[model samples]
Target: MESHIAFGYSFQAVGKGSCSTWGTGHFSTFDNYLYDFSGTCNYIFATVCDEITPDFNIQFRRGQNKKITRIIIELGPSVITVENVGIIGMRRMRTSSALKGPVKIVPPKADVGH
Candidate 1:
């Protein structure tokens, strides 16, 4: 549950089981921290920002037996301010099928305009 904010965005440590139940509000910030619990949970999603700055570093740690699905970083009605962009994990898959793969970092354009 350790979390912090970087460049006006919040980044927190999310457990494996916690990703499935996360809401859009959880991704309102420009950064996020994900921890893979021994590969128990294999999927993670997030809401992205409208503008992606260079300072946005989306960090992730995969446990022994876990894999990530869709890292949905949604763009909101505001500009995304950051200094770096990154994704740390296994392979990525286009679809979700309970299988293990890399971390899919999605940069979805914000539905609403800022």
Candidate 2:
């Protein structure tokens, strides 16, 4: 499994099903439902509803131009917020053992030659 860090929490993609939206508010649900929405607001795209307490939630914020402006992901005690401003920031839920400082983002190295 490949590990990825978003908003300071490390996770891996172990599931197959996924949801997606693109092109002027077009959306494709996990269950294969397709629709179009052009609202300028924050909306929940996906969330864990199997358990009494949700494990995670994903939301997207649409700007006035009908484009995605921000993405928010809530995983456990961490809330990761990514903006179209070119910087990825993370906010951890306040706790006695919460980590301090900002999370660093390193660009992946470009592959040269085959």
Candidate 3:
């Protein structure tokens, strides 16, 4: 079965934090989320990072096989809060190009009548 489970309790942080100590001008973190070519948020990040760059943003790519990942961003802020705590994948990608096409189903032959 596909796992639709979103790991753990979810929370949000909207101020400076531990990572904020990193500087007044340079960092951000996002979990379980990504920015598209149009620079829009299509999904929510599973995790978050403290703001350090005065005013900036965060981006992260999830993996296909990773269930858990711990990040310690030092170049951003000194403050950080871990809500919705749980395992997360980062920057996942396809392993094979052969699996990108349509699939064919085979049918079983009818049993011979006695």
Q: Estimate each model's TM-score.
A: 0.20, 0.61, 0.20
Q: What is candidate 2's lDDT per residue for 2-110, written digit by digit as tens?
A: 4333322222224534456665687766566888888987888777666476557777777888767777776666667766644244633333532322222222232
Question: Residue by residue across 1-114, what tens digits does model 1's lDDT show?
Answer: 533333222333244111222212223322234432334333323322343552223433233433232232323332322112323234322432332322233343334754
What order do you get sorting by lDDT, best first? 2, 1, 3
Candidate 2 error regions (>4 Å): 1-16, 86-88, 91-114
lDDT of 2 at 28: 61
Query: What is the C-alpha local distance difference test score of candidate 1?
Result: 0.31
Error of 1 at 92 (Å): 14
Error of 3 at 32 (Å): 15
Off by over 4 Å in 3: 1-6, 14-52, 55-61, 66-76, 79-114
What TM-score would candidate 1 get against the native? 0.20
